[model samples]
Target: MALNARLEIRQGQGLVVTPQLQQAIKLLQLSNVELEAFVEAELERNPLLQRDDPEPAETAEAPEAPAASSDELEFSDTSTAKADEAMDAEGDDRFADDPCAGGPPLTDWSRAGSGKATDLDDDAYDRALRRELTLSEHLTLQASQAGFTAAEAGIAQVLIDGLDEGGYLRLDFDETAERLGCSPELIETVLLKCQGFEPCGVFARSVGECLAIQLKDRNRLDPAMQALIDNLELLARRDLSALKRVCGVDDEDLRDMIAELKALTPRPGAAFGGEPAQTVIPDVHVRADPLGGWRVELNSDTLPRLLVDRRYHAQVQAGSRSDADKVFVADCLSQAAWLVKSLDQRAKTILKVASEIVRQQDAFLAFGVEFLRPLNLKTVADAIGMHESTVSRVTSNKYISTPRGVFELKFFFTAAIASADGGAAHSAEAVRHRIKQMVEGEGRDGDVLSDDRIVELLKEAGIDIARRTVAKYREALRIPSSVERKRMLKAG
Candidate 1:
């Protein structure tokens, strides 16, 4: 082999993902809330960017509506002239020398990716003021009044911080003592005192310890109760005879102890302040059209309306005295324009993907879950002339509100189960739903359907599913085994 350096002029196709293009591709996967936050951050960072909330007078004066979209289900006010102008951002000689003027890598919904932008992650929204004191806060207050020395109070704080989300202290005594440079005996003494704090089970190392602390606080942790706690595994398995022998109690006494155990709190931390629950907003709305098919529309409220303030850009550009200042203004304008264009493209892509989904699952939307045909990303991507990756990104974190119900976009793409008759394949989601219906409908006839029986029933309905697959689906649905159900029914 000869080692040589040669410049061979080989020209071929290649994908070059620029900084701006990368952000646009990322936008496709972001949920509505995330997209809103991303746009808001961009607006704040780029001085040339502004919200697209048109003034009332401007709206009235510009009543000569932009062309309506061919699909009734497209994004509302999508083709506003102002938005288009913002995207252009003085497309003149200034951008001729620009490095990032070329557009994005994904399929163009419009003339997007025509400029460059960067990405940012920021706090999108403010959570409402919640409950006053958190778990740590409450514990700190309790520790201050517990009459502990300063060193012991410090240890208590460390113990409080060490608690898991379920209020269990997962730290080992040896580890805590080593880290704090304290004696294991002192650590144990402090732990015993902290365990006596309010919300009795906060510093326990295990479920049994948590229950024991609660029982001890209630003055019910007798020797028999301690024995019962020691053998909680037998209680969980419902081996009442073994538990009675271990606790040395009669059946009635055992039942009473078990009932008392059930009354204690397992997770003391969960009752304290935590992150507020965030509400999911659907990105697409699907409803029946008056004349015929489904009409799909974007959730306009969640969509961020962005615009590039070219006038502000021009003002800043004119005021620039140095080369650095001019370059900064130009870059800001480019970034702002790219963000607006990316958002517009994002909305269009979401609408297109969502519309195709509605069309494919028409039967499902019209009827119910049983009618949902087996669908895949490739099917929708091929139908819409997009890549499978693009479809996947569009579906990620995206949701649709249909007349039937609100569902995530990815919910429509279920694995296919082979059909018994060699006809159309069955959707795994549909099969799971059928199983649930079958389970709920049973016991009315004084019978419980076992996994094997469910598989047979499904096969009779033209679905060729295995027994183990049926069992897996049953377990996923949290449905207990047939034997357990039979015992439960008898007890009922």
Candidate 2:
């Protein structure tokens, strides 16, 4: 009884994330580009998979006849213009059929996974149109026509290469000199030469220098402006009266000068750089139907259609006599099939979820930001008869293009706060947005919108928030206190 072990059978429920489930989760989180790449890889690997309605193959014609003359080549009667005109006509038809001609289109995710026929205005249209000019391209253009000598131009190229994204020359004179194997004085000269290039404010050593350089180029570098830039710390510290007195400028003139100074970019390098915008390929499209409800559809352009090659897989299976080979082939086939299934499920689930969101948030679209009700994963999950976790998974990294704008599925879910009048739950994000608007519209000379005053205003607007809550929200929004806000107003 003490040593012998008893064998017993028991049943218990356990959740297992099969390969299919894992693939669905993974597909949910991938950005549009990554998803496209994944689909392409599947297409290459899967023999049964083919692009739906592949474009007709273009045939290259053999030379119709040998050249008639040594100096002249005979032109075909079918000219490039005719071909271009035909292409243009086809393009016109394509555009005529485009559903998203007027505004950003809302697309469905069905096209993303099913590899089925989809509307032309699919996910590919959401990409940003602007292409950033790289530093090399920027510098090369300027350097080529900079009017500098060969040696000077070379030095300028070196300096241009050393510039950071903000277009600022980040290296010290001596360090740059050492790298160039030249004296510090020579480095300084090259810097001067480089500064004369296009983008007037570039090659500046500091914020003050950058602004000063720009002002000089504009021929607006007066003594007062010069002094202010030289002593930016003093300007930031509300020493404007001192600045006015020292610069011998009156209040209005000083104000005008300060405004002008503010217009100049402190970080000139920023002119040539920006944080790349997060590109979205919407998983679903929701549009206002003529029948007076939202029409939900999928963005098909971004999706890669795929299917397993039954023949190749069968051949491998047929030839493989060994257990190891059979096991490998079987595993691969199972994985491929699972991947396709997961992708289809992912698209369908996304479409289902997005349709629900549009239904719930339709009021938000009809009105504006003010009508946006507080929504959460639990609410959506309950409505759709799914677990909160499933809703969360569906929303993760998924974007929905709506009439309001493109928003992540998760963006609809925000913590709610009670409205002052005990009406409906207000979104915290909306409250913050309201608070920002109030602060922005506050008068400079009159009563400053204090946290208490903001609370009172919000109450009148049916947002019934407390003074402490207002203060908390204000602080969270990085807004200064009543006293600080008053002082800033006075200074302004």
Best by TM-score: 1
> In lDDT terms, which candidate is top?
1
TM-score of 1: 0.53
- Expressed as tens digits, the lDDT of each residue in 1-492 for candidate 2 is 589889999997442223233344456556566677667766665443544345321221111222212113322211123322443555531111111012221222332333222112224323322545655457667665543333344456557756777778877776655444456776687688667666777888888888888898899998878887877887899798888877788989989988998888776666664343345577666677787877777676655555555667778789989786665566555545555554554555566667777777777667643355678877886676544555666687677777745666765554667877888877766677688778877774477787878888888888877889877777765688879978987897
For each candidate in turn, the TM-score is: 0.53, 0.50
Where does candidate 1 stray beyond 4 Å?
Answer: 1-13, 56-70, 73-117, 122-263, 266-275, 429-492
Supply candidate 2's per-residue lDDT for 295: 77
lDDT of 1 by residue, 1-492 (tens): 999998889887433334554465667677787777777677767777777656532321111221122274333322223322433454422111111223333233233332333545523322313445767668878875564443465567668767776788977888666555568888898899889888879899999999999998889999999999999999989999999998999999999999998888889888878553356688888878889888877887877776666666667889999886876676776666666666666777778888888888887666554355678998987787655666787898787887744667876765778998888997665677688889988779989999989988988999999999988878766689999999999999
Against the unseen true structure, what C-alpha lDDT does each candidate score? 0.70, 0.61
Please count the clashing residue pairs in each candidate, in the order shown.
3, 12
Model 2 misplaced stretches (Cα beyond 4 Å): 1-11, 44-280, 367-371, 403-415, 420-422, 429-467, 477-492
**What's the distance in Å from true for residue 78, model 2?**
57
